[model samples]
Target: MDAIILQVLNGLDKGGAYALIALGLTLVFGTLGVVNFAHGALFMLGAFCAVTFKKIITLEQIVLSKTELSPWGTPLEIRTPYAQQWFGDFGNVLIEYSVPFSLLLAIPVMLFIGIAMERGIIKHFYKRPHAEQILVTFGLAIVLQEIVKAFFGANPNPQPIPQIFMGAADLGVMVGMAENVITYPKWRLVYLFFSLGVIAAVFAFLRFTTFGLVVRAGMSDRETVSMLGINIDKRFTIMFGIAAVVAGLAGVMYTPILPPDYTLGMDFLVLSFIVVVVGGMGSLPGAVLAGFMLGVVQSLASMTEVKDIIPGIDQIIIYLIAVIILLVRPRGLLGKRGVMEN
Candidate 1:
């Protein structure tokens, strides 16, 4: 029973990432029909945004301590983050909350990246073959990877979460089970809520607002929307930016879960593409749904008893499910008719 609960929680955590990335992919593909191979690179950039902010916050001044000396009789030097020295309590708070505060840096950086990619590169390929689009964007991904590596080095950098979220939550007590019977990390739970909040905000923006209505209308019929005098191209470009923000923020929040590395974006890129495919091309809800479902499936496959029966099941479970779904549903669980169709 405990094992089941644990796996489910783990699934939700993993699903949050999958769903967020795939959701961004859906936005671009569903509306613009552009297969963005560089989306994962956007995610990687976002994680590095967090790293950059962390470095900025932790920038320190070294001073000789009058009362302290090293074992070799040299004056001890002290290092303190700028935020800590500038704001005192607030500075400490900023340092403690650096991970979440990175949003300020990530949003603008990712927005610029998305817009530049679209206007400068992607728009030109809108009418080109998918093979050409793939080649160009794949090249862009490599370029982004090298740029990051050149600046940040090839080492993995770990980001710290707030002190308040450092420990596990007692889910067993909350659910009326014995205390400690079903404990889970607080940050993971926080991450799940954060992911859900972002997803909800995206849906709300698209469903309730006038801009969203226009975007939806354009998705249904681009020529019709253009005929009605709406600049569908500009809106599509903005949507691409929004997608970049989504991928970026997901990476920002996920830094503590997985350390930031130059290859992080590429790592998640393949899985997210598989997710987008399995969810059906150009299906928003399908992408979101498959993200969570695959996450749960992957988690369950990692269990001891399950693995005992099927060696290496956990690692291959996601790919296996992808194959089965492709064979059975083809368009995915909630994908619309005629999308990627015969």
Candidate 2:
């Protein structure tokens, strides 16, 4: 029972990430009817945004102290004690307090990147066939990845949990498991709740607001929305930005768990697609539910007994489930008949 509980918690964390990314993918596919193969790149960009912000936060202006004379009588330059104290000892010391600060810095930058991609690149491919769109987006993804590599290098960067959130909490007492407390990392728990809050806010915005209504109506029927003089194109561009921000924010919070890496976004791309498909494209509730469901299933597959019974079971579990779901329901669990039809 204790083990099962722990597995459940692990699954929720993984699900949170999958759900967030899948939600963005669904938005693009549902709203624009554009198969955004580059979305994983956006996710990658979001994760790298954390790395960029962290780098910027830790940057220090280099100042030279001219207290000593050189051999040619020029003053010698050395770093000041203040610099050492502020930055820490030795080579390439960081501010040690920059990870959290990255959150704010990453948002606007990511927003702009999202808008730029939508307006500059994605805009041109709207009317193209799915094959062309996929080819271009895939090519764009490679270009984006290469760009990130050029700027940030190819190595994975470390993103540690803040000093304050370095430990785990025991939740056994709350659940009547006095001797079997559920241990959870503080940062991860925070991320789980934060993700939930963001998702709720997104749903609420869409559910109660006119803007959301228009967007939903557009998703359901784009021509009608345009006929109603809603400037559907503009709204969709904004929606693209919103989707980017969501993925970026997910990347921002996910840094502590996986750390920010150039390839991190691509690593989860296939799984995210599966989640969207299984949830039924354009079905927000289904996306959310499937994200958590698959997350839990994948986590459970990691058990030692399960591993012993079937080698590589953990990895294929989610994909297997997706296959089963698709086979069972051609339109996916909650997909509409004409949602993705030509």
Question: How does each model score on TM-score?
Answer: 0.98, 0.88
Clashes per model (N, Cα, C within 3 A): 0, 0
TM-score of 2: 0.88
**What TM-score, to 2 decimals, does candidate 1 have?**
0.98
Clashing pairs in 2: none
lDDT of 1 by residue, 60-86 (tens): 988899999988899998888778888
Candidate 1, residue 37: the lDDT equals 91
**Per-residue lDDT of model 2, residues 1-342, tens digit only:** 778889999999889988988888888887787777788888778777777766655555545556877677867554444434565563233344455566676678777887898899889988889889888888888898889889888888778677778898888877777754688888888878977887898899889999999999998888988998889899888888888888888888888788666677678788898999899988888888888889989999999878999999998999899888888886678888866633
Off by over 4 Å in 2: 61-97
lDDT computed for candidate 2: 0.81
RMSD of each: 1.0, 4.7
| Candidate 1 accuracy as lDDT | 0.92
